[model samples]
Target: METSDQNAAVDALKDPEAFSVIIDRYRYQLSRYIQRLGAFDSDTTKDLLQESFIKVYLNLNDYKPSLSFSSWIYRITHNEVMMHFRYMRNRAQAFASEDALTLFESIPDELDIAVESDARLRSMHIAKALQRLKPEYREILVLRFFEGKSYDEISDILEMAPGTVATYIARGKMALGKVLQEMNITSV
Candidate 1:
């Protein structure tokens, strides 16, 4: 049977080796999330993931049962990425092509492309448009759409009020739509 994240956390607190379960469960999703946040390259994403996981391990005691474990972990990962951007004194760079393709594919319901070839062509445009968005909008949209987070989860992860999370998501979607329109790709 699959152990719950809460159970894994409690176990890890008692037996450090049990932390491996937490790591195994979160590793791939968090790695993809780190990359989607525009970590430059695989090495950068790996470094950030290592640092974030270390933080998660060290702060295991701080995990409140009130928040979902996924939200709490995502919060840590988000903070790590923000700190990396601040340290580098640069904004998020464009996502790698594969990341872009995956991101666009994840939101097909919102961006209804009729053909696979058109989807491929529009993926590049969408990536550039996303790159052009305000960091706040981009991050919120990424969390909401690509990461498949609910508003409450986003609120917990972003430490924002639920209403504020909803507002940001609305504005972010509008901004993304406007950007795509400006690119003359209005299928969305």
Candidate 2:
């Protein structure tokens, strides 16, 4: 059986238009991932997305189908996002974007709230709590929970060992739980 994106990568190499298919498949996911990494502005996020796709396309041959394609692409995206942070680090402004809240919106509410009037408020609180996390902790949480990547997949994406990924997820969950607790938000 072909790896998830292996065939697409092959076709993309032969036809430039085929690359668009891959872009369409991953654009939203990559956009969200980029935002999670600290990009908030549409312009900067768009630029990084384009740059990431270009890099992926150019490096298609280097991709090993034996590995998870999702991880490989995320690695590229992660690198681009990190570069953005490095560039913006000197500007003295923290990345505080409401776009991150949209990620929570994608998650289905466990129960319809007929009584609680503060669902949005709670979401904002969670978003702020997430932002308070160190980038590594936040990234691991996002990948494991939001992106739904397996430990080995996250390992490949972050270029760490699987054991390292597990350790990060464990520690990240604890850190996130602590932050939520500080905000009086019950752990879900």
Candidate 3:
């Protein structure tokens, strides 16, 4: 079977219809990322997705095929989320949506089946820890672990050096551990 063009940006620019393919590929994942990062309402999330896609379309010429297309789209979505965060800066803490919780559960873990019943508790602990983190740390960890992006991909998405991405992940994990410890979430 023939493969689709890997340079989606160029294809999308030349044929506007091709942009929908990018949207179709990224919309759901992008929505999940926005929800996890900012916990925006559905209306707001939809609006952000629209705006982000529009920007992606407009900026197609700027994309470089040397980088992963996934990373480029994620970087756009990440900026949109941060822009919304700035707009809603006065708001209080936003809880994770059910979808976010489901996504977290979908990731494989090393815990034994005996701990299956305790998953809810662990999820809550993690959610709280994530909320306590600074946006930079939280975002880096989310992109790496939740979205399954590599350090190089994250560096592309976040526009940081690879070493900086590693540092943030390490620091984010330490911060998460500290938060969990304070909440008495010690392991057996």
Which candidate number has the best TM-score? 1
Candidate 1 weakest lDDT stretch, 10 residues: 107-116
Q: Between candidates 2 and 3, which one is better according to TM-score? A: 3
TM-score of each: 0.90, 0.83, 0.85
- What would the per-residue lDDT of candidate 2 be over residues 1-188, giving only the tens digit for each residue? 53247788899999998888789989999998877656367788899999999999999999997787888999999887878778877311244446544765443232222122355655565566667888888888778777778888898899899898888877877777687777766644
Provide the global lDDT of candidate 3 against the true structure.
0.74
Residue 154, candidate 3: how far off, in angstroms? 0.7
TM-score of model 1 (CA atoms): 0.90
Candidate 3, 96-167: lDDT as tens digits:
545446545543242111122465665555666677888998898778878888889999999999999998
Which candidate ranks first by lDDT, i.e. highest? 1
Structure candidate 3, residue pairs in collision: none
Query: Residue by residue across 52-161, what tens digits does model 1's lDDT show?
Result: 99999999999999999999999999999999989998867767777666656545565332323565666667677777888889888888877889889999999999
List the candidate numbers ranked by lDDT, top first.
1, 2, 3
lDDT of each: 0.82, 0.74, 0.74
Scored against the true structure, residue 62 in model 2 reaches a CA lDDT of 97
lDDT at 73, model 1? 99
Find the number of clashing residue pairs for candidate 3. 0
